[model samples]
Target: MSEETTRGRAAVSGVAWRRRWRVPEKYRTKGTARPEGGGRSAGGDAPAPIRQWPLLLVLATTLVGLVVTLADFRIGLLIVGGALLTGAVLRAWLPAVGMLAVRSRFTDVVTYAVLGTAVVLLTLMAEPRPWLEVPFLSDILRFSVD
Candidate 1:
């Protein structure tokens, strides 16, 4: 091909490539919705650790609980539940919780609280001298089994 023709083809191909990779106008125009309390926990200029304190705290607590569970199941479970409960509390009260904010504030709080309560309750009701004894639960289990 002639020099001019080759250059023209190259330009056209470049344009085509750009068009193929470009974001759709509709999606580009639409604004993204940020999860509630999704901003940094600390100031914008804060260090990474400071900004993500909430997530770190929850994860650290969970890790500790898991490690403890290796030695003592009940206490470890309690600690895990407490960590989840703490996450719920922080999500509820903190204006910005960084990565801890996974959804709407209400949804996150409810999810965390429910999960924490369930864990703690189930742990307490574990076999062999259960701390929480629900008479109906035993009856229900028996009925279901029989």
Candidate 2:
């Protein structure tokens, strides 16, 4: 094809691509979807860290749990679970939890609660002691394996 025709076709293709991938009005307005409950944990006048206290708290607790994990696996797991549970509680109770609000209030709460509970339960059921054994779980495992 001629150079002019090639350039014309390329321009048309680019236009078509742009139209195909055009962002919606809502997304174009903000360019990002802020989490449903994500608002400043503290006042607007507060510093960035203070405003994001909930997220910082959760991250700090998780970090502590990770550090503890290096020394005591079970205890560390419990701490991690506690941290997640704390996040759930904070998300549920607080109207504006800054970065801690990853989704809608209900969704974030449910996710945190479920994950925290699972972690704690699994930790309790760790081998050599099995603090929170469920008799049916063993039966189910055996049935599935068999």
Candidate 3:
């Protein structure tokens, strides 16, 4: 390809990337934060920062699971697994996930669902007694213990 054509392609790609990932201009200025209403407002009426409620709920669930771990490992596993699965569902279905919407929607959904599934499977086969048997996972777990 000619140098001029390559440069033109690069410029076009750059514009696409910026449009996809750049923070909105309203969010750029610290002094004029966009309120929940999502419009520019005078300093006197600036709205509160938008909170990522789904992310907060996930964090709370995980913390509760950690606390429960002190009493019973299996129950803790169940709690954490449920939390992760809930997160996956939210990420997959919600149009706007607030701060939790980090990457592209498809990527985020896949990541959440995969991680949640793994956690659920591991929890079911966790120690104190395996609730579901996966031959490969059992072999790996035994190998690690030995």
User: Which candidate wins on lDDT?
Assistant: 1
- Model 3 over residues 1-146: C-alpha lDDT tens digits? 99999999999999999899989888786774422222211232433333456677777898999899889887886788788778778777765556566566667667777787788788788766789888987689789999
lDDT of each: 0.96, 0.93, 0.72
Q: Which regions of candidate 2 fall more than 4 Å away from where they truly are?
A: 1-33
Ranking by TM-score: 2, 1, 3
lDDT of 1 at 112: 99
In model 2, pairs of residues that clash are none
Estimate, for each residue in 58-103, the C-alpha lDDT of model 1 and write its tens digit.
9999999999999999999999999999999999999999999999
Tell me how candidate 2 scores on lDDT: 0.93
Instruction: Report the backbone clash tally of model 3.
Output: 0
Off by over 4 Å in 3: 1-50, 136-146
State the lDDT of candidate 2 residue by residue for 1-146, as single tens digits.
89999999999999999999998887666567888879788889989999999888999999999999999889999999999999999999998999998888999999999999999999998988888899999899999999
Q: What number of clashing residue pairs does each candidate have, in the order they appear?
A: 0, 0, 0
Residue 109 accuracy (lDDT) in model 3: 69
